[model samples]
Target: MRKLVVLLLLFGTIAHSQTQGFAKSSDGTPIFYRTFGSGKPILIINGGPGMNSNGFEALAKKLGEHNLTIIYDQRATGKSKLEKPSEKNISMDLMVDDIEQLRQKLGFDSWIVLGHSFGGMLASYYTSLHPEKVEKLILSSSGGIDLELLNHRDLVQKNLDKTYRDSLAYWDKKIRKGDTTYVTKLGRARALAPAYVVNPKFYAMLAKRLSQSDRALNTLVWLDMNRMHFDCSEKLKTFTKPVLILQGKRDIIPAELAERAHKVLQNSRVVLMENCSHYGWLDAENVYFSEIGNFLKP
Candidate 1:
């Protein structure tokens, strides 16, 4: 009876460690994070200058099956809150610092870093700031190491016909008028969903995820990034660590952007997924995971 009780207690403690929790950032802001699986640590940063980390939960779980995967809400998104989310509280430097602080709290001296979309930009910035702390770098549908992505017209928007554009405009007006209900958000997301995925079937899922974004944070982050002229290309040139730039051929973000990153990153490799869009995992699940799995292998 005593032995069984001890074993059960041990299992409970292990389970607690694998679940979700908060890590206080440098400025004492509690950053919400969730962990999955067990092995080498891999921190997955979701995009959205103001987006929460929930959208990456499925990806994290898949990665977690082989390694310890960590996903956290950025400073002001999801469960992570800031007392006053002003320009002073949020900046590119602060965002990078938050990742470092989380790393310290998590006790990982160095670990794999994976960033998706805008999250890839954050990961690049983080790597630029602390190259030594990153064992490997994975940029999935990344936004490149510079701000050039903003210069290009959104392919998704361009492809959208007048009807979709009109719908988007309608939702934008509602959102601007402070109607931030899920319905309004979902409506906005649905309008943009078609461009996000290659298959129409995944449109609803993509829209659901897109609707969860925190617009204020997104705007704030972009504002800060633009002010700082966010560019890590020079720093990445000096980084000799292994980097995997995985992008989809048909992604709204053009393939040339990934190629440009590959050129600047000294020790980087680019893998373009044919027929896949921004979300390669959804568009080409087997190939996506296979490439990631192989790259991460010892």
Candidate 2:
């Protein structure tokens, strides 16, 4: 009877660690995440300065099968609550602080951080700030890291054929006037443009998530956060772990910028997909999944 009780206790301890979470960010914004599988922990952050968990469900399920992945919505987005707006607070630093708190609360000593788009920007910045906490890093179709993207957005957009890009003129008008809602609307067009394995379902799901999001300054999610402020690029050079940067051939971030990040990182690699736009995962879902899967596996 004693032996059986001991075995049960051990099993319960292991099970509890495999998948659990119910926490909050430093601002008291309620935060939630799920841990699945059992192995090295991989924390996945969703894109969009406003995207929540639903945007990452497909990618998370794929990663969870191999390593324990914790996916959470950023504060004020999805189900998570954000800190009340304040003049001196609520900066990107706050975003990184939220990640740190969530990880500590979940008992993950370390994690392989994966961020997509805006999340990619956050992950790179976070890894730069706390290289000690990250085991590996992966970014997909992100425009956040390259400061030059500001000056070169035309070159980035020029990658698209004239016929297709003409559709975006409507967006340029809205962006110049300081509109937020239209920025979110263009996010789908930006993400799901090419005529390939386009998933209306995914786009619709993403749209729904944005509609319900507490997104403020929607345009800043990728560009502003992605920008390396005073300590960013200089700090990114300090990362020693392996890095993988995945970009679409026609995606907004210049192929050159991806190369620049690789050149700066202690060790990194870049993969460009053919006939794909910004959302390489959707443009080349199978390849994207396999690329990240192989890199994250032990």
79-141: candidate 1 lDDT, tens digit per residue? 998877888889888888889988998899999999999999999999999999999999999
Candidate 2 per-residue lDDT, tens place, 50-95, comes to 6567667666666666667788867666666555544233467777
Every candidate's lDDT = 0.88, 0.69
Candidate 2 vs. true structure, TM-score = 0.76
On lDDT, the candidate that comes out on top is: 1
> Against the true structure, what is every candidate's RMSD?
3.3, 5.6
Most TM-score-accurate candidate = 1
- Residue 162 of candidate 1: its Cα lDDT? 89
lDDT score, candidate 1: 0.88
Candidate 1 contains a number of clashing pairs equal to 0
Lowest summed-lDDT stretch of 10 residues in model 2? 191-200
The residue pairs found clashing in candidate 1 are: none
